[model samples]
Target: MNIDPQKPLLQLNVGEFLDLLKNSATEKKYEYGLKGLAKMLGCSRSKASVIKSTGILDEAIVQNGNLIIIDKDKALQLLAQNKK
Candidate 1:
């Protein structure tokens, strides 16, 4: 997958993110922290909840309520458009 060097992060709306997850190649279990994810996303917990509740993000794995790791490649691809 080619990523544009100029762009940094992909600004995805709720639907786009969900589509990416639905079309992911790997179905293996993944994990990550919600708080950490919120920090990484630069958004609040509320926002994350909204996205999840709306089915924008598929939450198949959540351990101890802190840790979320999905198909990294799929996520990157979804956001990769920004760089392009």
Candidate 2:
């Protein structure tokens, strides 16, 4: 994954995002926090939050009393399905 610093990260469609995550996972871990997920999806935190609020995505885990985590693969699938 060679990302050129001078260029913008490609805004991936849902399928591409899922494939990228599948190829990048180690030990099958594909979860990310809201901030990290926004980065992965090439969107802002508020946008991600809105998407989540619309029931297109859900928290995959919650830990340490306040941390919320999402499954990237699942979110991508839901987003893709929602578009259909």
Candidate 3:
């Protein structure tokens, strides 16, 4: 990494910094288990299981044995892409 002292770094006010943090935190929410996934998708557990089996959201899914975790934003994006 090269440091360029001549270039000033970006600055943010306290409110702007807080807003950025809040947006970042909301942007990458994780949902755990089938119930959580269903809640995230606004669908039933059965439908969520079916969607999981389709493998369309595989990139957003993390599984270990019986445990499942989903990246809500990524899954929603994938679903939106597939809706087209």
Candidate 4:
């Protein structure tokens, strides 16, 4: 059987996209530790240490037991703000 080229593709709004991402493996894949956050932000480890000291990353970063995770969306927003 052949498929129609004009068939519409699936669509998702911003909220739906966020929800789907939250429910998907993308959450874990996107989350980062302080080291990973530094890498993603294109900053040095010392800079990350300074950020940690400032506590701005406190709300953006989460510590679950020994696992340190940076909130993906929050981290992206923080990166954008720092670029300005």
Q: Over the stretch 1-84, how does candidate 4's per-residue lDDT look in tens digits?
A: 233345443555566656655665544535556688788668887887787667666768878775888876786777667663
**Better candidate by TM-score, 1 or 2:** 2
**By how many angstroms RMSD does model 4 differ from the true structure?**
9.4
| Comparing 1 and 4 on lDDT, the stronger one | 4
Model 1: how far is 16 from its true place, Å? 43
Candidate 3 residue pairs in clash (backbone atoms < 3 Å) = none
Superposed model 2: Cα runs more than 4 Å off? 1-28, 59-65
Model 1 stretches with alpha carbons more than 4 Å out: 1-31, 59-73, 76-84
Model 1 scores a C-alpha lDDT of: 0.51
Alpha-carbon lDDT, every model: 0.51, 0.66, 0.83, 0.67
User: Clashing residue pairs, candidate 1?
Assistant: 31-67, 31-68, 31-69, 32-67, 32-68, 32-69, 33-66, 33-67, 33-68
Estimated TM-score per prediction? 0.36, 0.53, 0.66, 0.51
User: Backbone clash tally for model 3?
Assistant: 0
Alpha carbon lDDT at 3, candidate 4? 30
- Sorting all predicted structures by lDDT, with the top scorer first, yields 3, 4, 2, 1
Worst 10 residues of 1 by lDDT: 55-64
lDDT of candidate model 2 versus the reference: 0.66
Q: RMSD for all candidates, in order, please.
A: 16.6, 13.5, 6.3, 9.4
Worst 10 residues of 4 by lDDT: 1-10
- Candidate 4 backbone collisions, by pair: none
Question: How well does candidate 4 score on lDDT at residue 49?
Answer: 70
